[model samples]
Target: MGQRTVIPFGPQHPVLPEPVHLDLIIEDEKVIEAIPQLGFVHRGLEKLVQKKDYTAFVAVTERICGICSFGHSLGYSQTIEVLMSIEVPRRAEFLRVIWHELSRVHSHLLWLGLLADGFGYENLFMQCWRLRERVLDIFEATTGGRVILSACNVGGVNQDIFDEDLRGIVRVLDGMRGEFGELSKTFFRDRSVQNRLGGVGYLSKEEAQDLCIVGPFARASGVEEDIRSYGYGGYSALASFEPITSKRGDGYARCEVRAREVLQSMDIIAELVDKIPDTPLMTSVKGAPGADSIAVSRLEQPRGECFYYAKGNGTKYLERFRIRTPTSQNIAGMTKTLQGCDLADVPLNVLTIDPCISCTER
Candidate 1:
């Protein structure tokens, strides 16, 4: 073997969205081993539960990640609802699902843009973000905030959209769908994109499962596990919903999974709007959770399955709160994908997993 050399991969990079450092060991221009260093921007958001109380903490959870902000808020609220035995109303559930799916579409669009930029496809990158702005506009129109939406609460959603607004949302999605097709064609058929993504960063199904990878990473590897299938937030109403998967388990497979998921999200939003009941947007949640009660909730976020745990001691405050983001769980898989790849492709493999360092460190 050639003499090994160590090189730091991140904490700051042109393509990465958040700060995550990697100590890469390379020999003759190929990575021999890869190690990750986290906590560069650890915000300790979970610890704020002790000071904010259960009802007030929903706002804090929404700030954990901008791309998946609504998902985090929904997860935290659902956990509290479970602990307090509050039954969320049917209409609220449907509305929550609508917002959650919109968030997913926004996140995937952002990822697709980043992926295009990673391989120097700057035109495609610009096209993807340009389309993504329509999704953000829908968010701002409904929730009054494009990124950090404070729309979910412990019992239900904080706001409601009229039937007219829902119809407008569908129109926006229709326009987006048309524009997205033109952009995605470049991702699927362009020679340059295929050359950079196809057959690169391969991960076997067994390796993905062993690493406990979640979200699109696991699905792209054919794991067939999507937490949305468990039926939280009106997902159960869509009986035919199935997790998207590809057996190839490579960078191309990952990109395909996310691309298809964006289309699927549009379908889901339309279905929810059609079936949404005309009832109150939120239910009253009273009293604190029972003493020593513990609740755990899982939801399929844009990145992957996000797990939330909340414990109560019958006081005004929560005893403990914990979050396990998908990026944190996929670090092992990241290391596996890094080995034996060219040094230049390191960022491509890393971005393919769609790492959200803020979510991981929070």
Candidate 2:
């Protein structure tokens, strides 16, 4: 047997994107187990609902994680909309979905860049980020902010994208699609990449379901789970919708699923932008939620399913607010995959799950 030692992998690491810490038990060069250390960046954002009114708290929810910001605001607003029985306009729904899918594209691209960097491919990393900037430009044109748009409100969106601009957005994405397709070749065909991730961190469908994994991680394992298919928001208006999935259930499969999802998001955006109705953007909200009222909403974020829960007591301020981020749900699976992995490949395995430590801590 190899000599045993304990290694700590970042709340800070050169290659890790999020501030995630793992206590790894090593038997020689192989990982025997990995234990997650949480709350490194917790800020008590959920408790802020007590001080912020239901309408005002939309901003707070959006701040949960910059990458998943739109989904947070959308889900929190949806929960409040449910609590108050507010029916948002059809146009608003479509706009919300457009922004949400764009956010997903940005997130997946950023992740792809980080993944490339993890493999020491500096040029590829920069190329991935360069493509991501175009998505950010679209956000800046539509909502006036690159990261935190703060466009979603309790009843609907705060503003609308002009029809011309929406079409322009589609054109820009069409231009980028070809570029991204060329870049993805490295991830799929490169011998180095395949050796690094192809068969690493294999998780069977049963194990994924057993761990209650969500998002690309679960989909890669053949779980066939995606919250968007439920057709919430503008998704209901789409011609057809299906979850992107793979049965490989390995590190490469996870990468493949997310890479494909980036294209899927672009298509969803194109559909919503084309079909969006001509209606009012914002619907005025009045009165607080009913006393002792509770409502919940789930959104399929870039990484996976994010759940928001809210409770009200006949007041503007929510009595309780909570969020169960995808990272939180997938942490167990991360540790599970860590078992029996080579120490050098730990980062690749961890990145495949796309751990959002900030979201999880929040």
Candidate 3:
């Protein structure tokens, strides 16, 4: 047997943009085990539920992470809406779907770029981010912020995208399709990318289900679990929605799943814009939450499933607010995948699950 060596992967590493630290125990070049260290960037955003009123905490939740900000905002707002029994308008629902899907597109594009960079494909990385700029531009044009979109509220969305604006967004998405298709070919067919990712980080379908993995990570393993299929927000109106899945259960499969999701999100947005009704954007929110009321909201975030729980005490402030981020749930699976893999593949394997340390710890 080869002598064992212990290595510290990162609180900061070139491949990972977040502050996830891993202790890898290896025999020669093969990793025998991995232990994760979290909480380096915990912001205590969930703890602010007591300090801020339910209405004001939506913005607080939005600051969980820049990449998944909209998902956090939506989950928190949806929880508050349930607590208050706010009937979010159809137009508002549709608008929420539009922004949500656009955020998904934006997130997937960013991840693809990061994944490309992880594989040392700099040109591919640049191309992916260049396409992502269009999505961010749409965010700025519609909601006034590219990252922390303070557009969602308790009852509904704060901004109303006009027909002209919707058309413009559509134009931008359409323009990217060809270029994105070309970029996807590189990811799917390039020998270097395939060599780096294709069979690494294998998670079988049963293993994924047993770990209760969420989002594309699970879907890549052929587990057809997507919280969006439960029909929240504007997703209920889209009859054609289906969770994308791949049977390969490896790093390449994970990449393929997200790459396809970007296109799927575009289609969903088109469906939403075509059917979005012209009506009031925001509904008036009145009264404090009912005493002893508890609200829970779950949705398919860009990462996976995200959960928000809120408890009321008959006052302006919520008694408790809790979040369950997908990365937290997937960490065990990540650790399991790390066992018996080459040390060199560790970063790419970890990136396959797409950890958001801030969101996970917050």
Candidate 4:
């Protein structure tokens, strides 16, 4: 047998912003197997459901991850709506869709920057983040918070977009479309990026499906299971909406899938703004009494499909709240992809899974 060396990749690595430890076993330059250690950032947020009122619990859900904050809150709200059988106003749903897609764009741009940084492309990283700043500015203007929007509520949204603000958002997204197209072209077509990412850390479609990967990870492997297809929020009315999928299942494929999604999200937002129906933004939600009714709700967050389970026990406080984020589901597939990869490709492979540790631990 050849000599094998064990190496610890992270709990606090420069490449990863989140804390995820990987114990890698390698022979020379090729990784043989990887053991992942999670729970470093576990905050026990799930246990808080019993202590906090249903309304206040939204804040806890939003804290799952700074990047996917809106998605978490929206999923939480949707779950509660299911439990209460409340039909959110059409306008509120549209607004929620707008914020959700904006959050998606922002999150994807942030990931693009991080991926660029991982590859030592400092200028590309900076450019991606500069574009992300525009999305953050829009979030602050509409929701009063840059990272955590806190705009979603149980029955509806807390804020409404004025006609002027709507037009401004459209203009910003239109401009961003051109910028994103250029950036994506450069990133995808550039020889250096292609050489580094193409055919690296490949996950076959069968492997991805067998392991049950989620979000862009699964989409890259030709899975078409986007929760948006369920017609929740305003997605049902989206005329040109289609979930992006690729069969290559490599790092390059994951990047391409995300880039395509960014464009699709922008298109959805534009359609939403154009079809804005005049209606009240919120509705009063009253408690429904039963023997702790539970409901499941799922949404296609930028990271992938997020699952929320909520149980109400005829009280202000929820009896139980469980959230299963996409990252949690993708962990297994990530470990599988790490096999036979070089140590240098680990970061990109891990990131291709988009490991949102906070969401997983919560």
> Which residue pairs clash in candidate 3?
none
| Superposition-based RMSD of candidate 1 using all C-alpha atoms, in angstroms | 0.9
Q: Over the stretch 116-173, how does candidate 2's per-residue lDDT look in tens digits?
A: 8887889989999999999999989888999999999989999888999999999999
Candidate 4 local lDDT, 1-362, one digit each (tens): 56899999999999889899999999988899999998799888888988888888888888888888988998999898888888899999999999999999998899888988888899999999999999999999998999988999989999999978998998999999898888998898899999988988899888888988889989998988788877888887887557799989898999999988888888888888999888998889876524569899899888888888887788888787888888888999989989999988888888877778988887
Per-residue accuracy of model 1 over 1-362 as CA lDDT, tens digit each: 78999999888988787888999999999999999999998989888988998888888999898889999999999999888889898889998999999999999999999999999999988999988899899888888898998999989888999999998898899888988998889899998899999877899999999999999999999999999888886897885788999998999999999999999999999988888888777789888888999999998999999898999999989999999999999878988999999999999999999998889999
Stretches of candidate 4 exceeding 4 Å from the true structure: none
Q: Give the lDDT of residue 342 in candidate 1.
A: 94
- How high is each candidate's TM-score? 0.99, 0.98, 0.99, 0.98
Tens digits of per-residue lDDT for model 3, 1-362:
99999999998899989898899999999999999998799878887889988888888889998898888888888988998899988898888888888999989999999999988899999999999999999999888898999988888888888898898888889899999999999998899999999899999999998988888999999999998888887888887778999999999999999999999999888878888888888889999998999989898899999988889999999999998999998998999899999988999999999988888998
lDDT per model vs. reference:
0.91, 0.91, 0.90, 0.88
User: Clashing residue pairs in candidate 4, if any?
Assistant: none
By the lDDT metric, which is better: model 3 or model 4? 3
**Over 4 Å off, model 1:** none
Where model 3 places Cα greater than 4 Å from the true spot, the runs are none
lDDT of 4 at 254: 90
Clashing pairs in 2: none
Root-mean-square deviation of candidate 2: 0.9
